[model samples]
Target: MDNDEPLEPETQDEPETEPAPQNSDETLYCEAEASVAVDKDKAARESSETDLEIEDTEKFFTTGQRELYLEACKLMGVVPVSYFLRNMEESYMNLNHHGLGPNGTKAIAIALVNVSNNDLGLEGARIISEFLQRNISSLWNLQLSGNNFRDESAELLCQALSSNYQIKTLDLSHNQFSDKGGEYVGQMLALNIGLQSLDLSWNHFHVPGAVALCNGLRVNTTLQKLDLSMNGFGNEGATALGEVLRLNNSLVYLDISCNDITNDGVSKISKGLEVNESLKVLKLFLNPMSMDGAVSLILSIKRNPKSKMEEIDISNVLVSEQFLKILDGVCAIHPQLDVMYKSVQGFSAKKALLQWTNPMKLIQGYADQHKITVLDFFKSLNPKGVMTMPVGDFRKAMIQQDKVPVNLHQVRELIRKLDDKTGMVNFSLLKTVKP
Candidate 1:
């Protein structure tokens, strides 16, 4: 019974007491102050030389190691739910490893949840779409060419573009999109606000698809460079595109080569150029615009007061001397039209002759004054310097081998003499000589 009364007097000293005259709030304030002081002291001690003597530590994973780690996490069902959520701050740093490295397959799935809400079965597509959407403002040079994307994939891409307002350069070249995909992309362009350059070359956009794009360009004002080359747009497509150019003031460079465009197509484009003052570089090469079309274009250039065209490529067009004369006249007058002519080696020999004929004649006459004949001039013109004469009528002159100019009668006499001697006239030698 006595153990309950004197138990405390026999043992340890009592703890120290504080004066508590403060109100409830003040007491709480004091307790907070005491707690803060204790924490400060503990922090100071923990940061002392003893703790400093311990080595600082960090963890780094190589690309391959990170891939294995993420793969293991995925297989263990720990990545998509917990690992990614816990490492959001490091996600971007890890992206180079996961998105562009071996572990990219696993990291892309987790990253998609943050950017895209699409349930695309492929892991990278949804993730990349989302990343582009989120970083659209910073992705000025986005190159997604040769991605093997389908029409449905283009639809999803258009959906992303409809919401994004900051991508400036988009290279969608070498894709498998047809007119339907082009229509979808055209619709996106009609609504997109920040795109400046679009490369749709090598796509399969026919006249109908071009019409859709024309409709889009009629409204879009931010696009500056558009590459529609290699699309096989014929006269009808050119006409449709010309309609848009008449109204569009933002576009500066237009490439419409290899489109099978004829004079009618060039006419449509000229009509658009009549009003367009912003176009600088126009590529009309590899089209079927004949000499007449080129002459028409030269006339248009002469007439257009707003024609500030800096570069014009009329290569592969059937340009005759008349067309070149017109172009030279325009160049003499304007002096600003920088024309590019890609001469076909053989097909353009006539035009080349017309161009250098006067100079060639002057040089040849100077050489002839030194005893050079027209045959000698032809020999000099040929790469091997071997004179090959004309056939038929010229062959007759060859039979008369004497240097003296022979008349038709003497040519016949020589042919008969050769026939009598050899039983046959040497027509092969006749074939190589000029009249």
Candidate 2:
């Protein structure tokens, strides 16, 4: 017999059997099975339909809804309100028959603030404040970044912060708050003690605004992380803020990028770091610092052996090989000085030209010929100091020399060949063509 073949019943003598009985239990079992099958099919259909509806709803958001959502995000410093509301509605409906949506107002009220429209993100704040007033013990996280907020709007926010104590994180980045508006918010920070992370980046917080904020930081101990990037604070402003950092021990992360801080500003901050131990991350990108400023910072890092600073950014500052060597030496010695170099991005035309002039391969070859490292040769050329030269001047200087440095010409030829192959070079080569 084949292993896969079906078995056949064997013929045998059979006995007589009693007739079947009609009972309610049999009827009920059959009905229950049928009902279960129907319910399963309905559930499958409903689930598929719900998924399709959610997809369609995602595709159908109106401009008004998007604006309202963005505004709510700026005021409350959280994810878009619509997204939060949708999830909250689903949760509420799943938990109870509370159809808290367009279908149920009470459910909607319980789940969402319904601030569909209104300027300065006040409606959402008002709703959240009102909810807290009713509950008295609920915790919330508010993030209101990238909204166009004016002075009047900031006042309402101050009022909300004055009363509410549950909100822990408040992000107010990218708002159009000037000195007056920032002062109002600063007042709130001074009195309110519940906030931990306050992000005020991309606002118009100039010197006056910073001074006002320093008043709050001086008194408030609850705030731990503060971001003040793209606010245009210069040396004086940073000096004032540094004074506050010197005294305050709660702040850990300070971001001051895109400011007009030069060597003087950095010097002031260095002074603050001398005593300040709580600060861990300090961002100082897009500042007008030369090698002098950089060296000063390195020296300070070396001096302060007990500083808690783990990372430092000196990007976009005019730096040289000497600066890099010093930083390399510092890293070798300290092992904790996490220094970052200015990347190729946003390099000035002059800087880019210089990089093209003195390619790294050429420098390495020149150093090899001189029986020393590239760093030593660079130091020898400018014994006292080497300022960051412009790209064009550096290129011209390299080519104008009597003899082209070893490997310099070779690297340039290689770059030209690659550029030609990639269709990037449309001009004639600078030097004579070599095989």
Candidate 3:
């Protein structure tokens, strides 16, 4: 009994002590500390990766070259960008979406490299012009599209280009350069002898500027391809281009689409093609020309058996039976000649009735198709027995498919031809000979 009592007393006296329960806040603090340590390690690794990338980029240029670029930046009072310097050593430099303002642009231009989509304003252009005047041989292709270069900036660039002969391809598209800029470009083109391809598309060049540019092209002996699309070069501008084609022997490919050129402008171009033996490709699409103008173009090709015209793009101009016939004839002679055209002209119909060569044929075709006499159709349109109708009414009637269908331009031409001094179409003229 005594041994059992001693053992029980000893066990009661020595109650085991368990570890204190860990606090919730202490556990959270430990986890946060570990997370912070991991983040610090990751940041160190990222910093090392960035340093390695910089080292790799530095391998692209020699120490001397790097120093030169840095010195240029220092002299120009600009800070050098790491990516720009790295890209400058490559064959093609892509600086798109880089908000390189005027100062940044000047720094890049001093390096004489190709870049795009920079907001290089007038000051930037002036800086580049200074480099261009230096006649740097390293820079061959200059692409300044979508840079917001206005007339003044373009003028500065053109002046610089006048003395430089090393550049071969120059793209000044999608800029705000107007006629003043165009005049400057023309002057530069006249002097520069080494440039081969030029793109001045999507600019604000008008008749005067376009004519001036063409005048320069006429004297230029080196340029091979030119793009003047999406400008305001109207009939007079086309006339000047025609003159360039007539004289210039170097230009092989030309694009003058969407230049507000009409039938008269096309006629002028046709006249130039009659004697031009060097031009191979001509793009005149999106101009408000008709089948008559197309026919004239084909005939011009026919007249000049020596003409080297291989491709003619008039895809915006509609096709007609007479035009196809003439095209077939011309193609028989020039088997290599390619003519690009789209749908036939009409109001939702496949074949158009209106043709500038002969409006009477259109009237006769509709008259025969609807089984009505010309005089009767005119009377239906007039219906007043006054033998005359307003020009607008005649135009509306001519535009209807059930009636004498013609396009708006054809109606205007018809009105001009048939309307007496009273601004009214004489329906009675249907009975007389063709006016």
Candidate 4:
């Protein structure tokens, strides 16, 4: 080779590449086992993490509930009551008559709980409405009875409840709310699907409000118990409720007592009872309705083939012999029904017919013996000169030997003939009688 080419011949030894490592079964097995071991470790770690997450979630909910109580106590500006603090998880709480005014009541409402008779004024109701609208809490039963909630508070609460699907029972009795509040409540009832029991007694729901409420009930199928007692709902209200009874099938207990309903109203309601099939208890006590109205109502119930009426309370309404007879006939057919009444309106004693053949003559004799005009005699009986007195009071005077010299049976008959259906005896009517 030439000298330049010969220099290239002194080549360094290239390290021989070892044959690529031959795949061994044992090595492949070791690698596969290592991969499986890694996967198992990862899975164990993930499972432990999931368990920890579950534990954390439980702790979070518990802490949240306690936080609600703590927040309420803070807003109330008082230490947590020991009973509530000790039983933080208890569902029922009775803090009635606690003197928790607006601020304290607001605090309690934020917790979405009960503290009835706590003087929760309109401000407290506002707070309750705010939380209800937020839809965070899961409160079901709400008792705000004896709270001083007004129309605005009622509107706010109704607005919240219109969309909420949680609350089941609500008590708004003994409040100052009136027709405006009642209208709002009616609107709420029209939209609400969860409420079942509502107590609106001792409010000022009159004809318009009552009609609106009943109209709402006509469409509602959830409410079971409704207390409209001690309101100003008159015959118009009764008529509206009668229409509701004709259509609604969910109402089971209806307390319309002490609502100034009269014979016309009862007659209207009787028409509904003729068709209704779900009403179990109808409370008509403490009303101005008479035996005729009560009798008509009972008869209507009897006429219904699908009536589920269990009890009809007309305890304060005066009954008659005819009413008792009709009731006996109805009870014979529906022995499961119970009718409650207090007294009979007419005289049933044997001597009553013989003694009081002419009640006007007996009264005229009493006035002549007293040497006073008939009007003057009534004026004497009525000390206040109001020209009217309770039938019971007039009956008491009639039975006094020195006053009217009439027997009990005779006095009852006289009052029955003279009663104005308002349980009042008008003195002006005596002027028309030629006794």
Candidate 5:
């Protein structure tokens, strides 16, 4: 042993170890490191993609069209993540709400011809008219809502409607179109047989406009649904539309809610409905059609067995106890027809009941599993075959074993609604249940 270093183990002579090949042809020393570098580069690219998401958010939402859309476009900043990832419809909606110039509107209109979103909202006035003039034949639906459309744009629309046949749905709501615009719309309605749905809501088109539109409807048969809500259609307008309804055989759904129409107006509609057979759904909310007008409509419905109306919306109307009594009488006659009595608040009772826990689904599953009706399932729980059970036991059995989470109070009310003769739920009355 030497003093300077520890003694090393003396071994037999061996050949220098060779670098092993990682693959059949690849060497560990150089080529393997190269493959690792390539993998690292690919990983770097993915990391940069994530970094791009972070960096893009810093300057997102460029308020490009703020001035044009007024305050409505204030929030129309380009959110970096959604902007790049959003589909055509999202892009169109974002483009629609914000302010856009003529060139921009034209671009969007041209783009819409190829996309599923046939609706374009060009707040740009003349640009929208020009787009309609050019692409009206290509579009199936055009929504020019909230545009400052006066007679000039109306003339353009009328010209488009005269020759165009492809466009079916047009929404010109939330504009300042007076009688002049309405007259042009009437001309369009008279000429365009392809138009099915028209929404002229929330505008200044009053009784004259309504009359002009009705004049067009006299000859038009293809129109199915019409929304003239919030256009201040007084008694005169309502009367005109009522007369048209009598003749317009193809029209199915009519929404004249919040149009300030009165009993005299609805009286005309009632008379028209007596002769009408195609109209199925009628919306008459937010109007002060005191009990008399509603009664008139109800009486007309009762008289006409051929009346196809399955639903009537009388929510928010000024009704007395007499009105409800009359409605109950009407319902007693036609339990299949749905009469919406109360206004839907911030939420819908039916919608919530369906969404939250799906107790109806649970009951349906139980009924299917047992191969019996829900009524039969309840009968199984009772020892004696009585027509009814205590509400407490019924609720407990459902909640504890079957796990149905329907509202107890609503259940009680539903029992009463189903069986007017008994305070408890009688399953035989299930035949009266309507969807």
Candidate 6:
């Protein structure tokens, strides 16, 4: 009997009935017949379990996640605890999704210490918290994003991380953890020395929460990467993070994009960068920083020319040609730094028509290198202006030179839907000067 494979129902031809003499030998045959009947009944019972059904989820998880799930199932009496995990082991082992409610979570948590791809939404918060509280495993890598497990989940997870010595990464992004929840997470970070990465993006982390997080970072030294993007952390939060950058030596990557951070906040961060040396990558896209803030940041990095900091994202931020020229000269000299100056333009029917047909015209960056009106950056597309610029070529240039991650298939689909007839864009017709 192999444990890995389920027991199959037995199929043996029944023997024909034979007349027996009324003697002592007849008693032994009756006993043997009863035992055979019981064995046949047991096989039928086991075969019924193979009918268990489990649906597959779209998301896929790594091998470790699947192994953890299976270990838990086996501990919880693999046959009795059923939500189709046992039947469809190969197909739906990694996909623990919406169907698993609080009951399902509690059932699995009976044996599970680590879990992922399980969207045990609001209903499963209490169950998940209880599991974390009682969980015995040391190496815990929880990916509970999009669960909507608000304040309680945050506090519970914080408590778990505080005691657990093997916490590697805690990804709570896209949860309803506001600044209040963030405070709990920060408090935990101050104590937990084993945690390496923390992602709190797409939550409701504002100034007060950001302040608490920085307060934690000021003392803690294990965390290396912090993502606070898509939150409501404005200048006040940015200011606190800048202080963290100044004090914390372990942090290397910081993403603060789409947070509504402006000139004041950016300037303060620049001041921190001037004195700091550990940070290598900074993402500041979609912020409303003007030329002064941009210039201040460029000059701040120039002061520490040997700083390990190599990349800065200023895409969609208000930038002047002078700042672009200054940045281009700095990049040319260092050659180690890559200043991403991709300015994303909003959807425009007219602009799309022009950009699809001709080379794009912009104010700075590559265009300033040759002292040309940014159109020279895309000269590779057309040498004689005879070849019309298409979205495919534009995507290539954006990806190759500027390092803009634009998939030509996706970009082409968007452009084709916008202007199906031409299937081209003219970048030279970009509106450079405003009225």
TM-score of each: 0.54, 0.53, 0.61, 0.61, 0.56, 0.57
lDDT of 3 by residue, 42-127 (tens): 43433233211335677776553455455445444444555565666676754532334455555566465444566667766776
Candidate 2 lDDT by residue in tens digits, 1-435: 332343222112222331122221111111112247766574343323321122335544433233333333333322222223344425343212111122123222323332222233545445444444443434455566654666666777776776676677777787778888778877988887788888888889888877887887877787788889999778877887788778888887788988898889888887777777677667888888766777777777666666656557776766676676677566544443455546433446875565455454665677688688654543343324352332222323344343335222333443344244422321233233333
Quality of model 1 by C-alpha lDDT: 0.56
Model 1 C-alpha lDDT per residue in residues 1-435, reported as the tens digit of each score: 222232111111212331222221111111112346766574343323221111121133223223433333333222221223334335462221111222323344433322122233333444445545654234455555666665666777777787787778887776667778778888998998889988888778888788777888888889988988888678998998788778888887889888889999998888887777777668888887876676666677677777666557787765554565677677554444555665432455554445433333443456567786644543443344443422222323332234443332233343343342422343334334433
| lDDT of every predicted structure (CA atoms) | 0.56, 0.56, 0.71, 0.71, 0.59, 0.59
- Compare candidates 1 and 3 on lDDT and give the better one: 3
Q: Which candidate, 4 or 5, would have the higher lDDT against the true structure?
A: 4
Positional deviation of residue 294's Cα in model 1 after best superposition, in angstroms: 2.2
Check candidate 4 and list the clashing pairs. Answer: none
Clashing pairs in 2: 74-144, 76-142, 76-143, 77-142, 77-143, 77-144, 78-143, 350-391, 353-391, 354-391
Regions of candidate 4 where Cα sits further than 4 Å from its true position: 1-86, 91-112, 345-435
Q: Write the per-residue lDDT of candidate 4 for residues 1-435, one digit (tens) a residue.
A: 122221121112223431222122111111112247766574343323311122233333344344555455454443333323434455665443233445544555555466567676766676667667767766788888887788988898899999887889888889888888878988999999999999999989999899888878999989999999999899999999999999999998899999999999999999999999899889999999888898898899789978878668898987887787788677556544667777666756764466556767876887788787777876677668777887645754554437555544455556656678765888778756555
**Each model's Cα RMSD:** 25.4, 19.9, 23.3, 28.1, 19.6, 15.1
Report, for all candidates in order, the number of backbone clashes.
Answer: 1, 10, 0, 0, 2, 16
**Candidate 5 wrong stretches, greater than 4 Å:** 1-106, 113-137, 318-322, 332-335, 343-370, 373-435
Residue runs of model 2 more than 4 Å from their true location after superposition? 1-137, 332-334, 343-435
Local accuracy of candidate 5 as per-residue lDDT tens digits, 1-435: 122332222112223442221221111001112246766574344323421133344343222221122111112211111222222334444322122333333343433432113233333444445445554234587666765566666777777776676778887777678888788888888888788888888878788887897898878888888888887888998898888878888988899999898899999989888888888778998877876787798888787776766557777755555665676566555443445555323545766565445344566677888688766765765557665764334433433444345543334444454444522446566565542
Residue 158 of model 6, lDDT score: 83
Residue lDDT tens for model 6, 124-227: 55444544555454445666667676877778778867766466777778878887887888898898888877888888988888888788888888887788
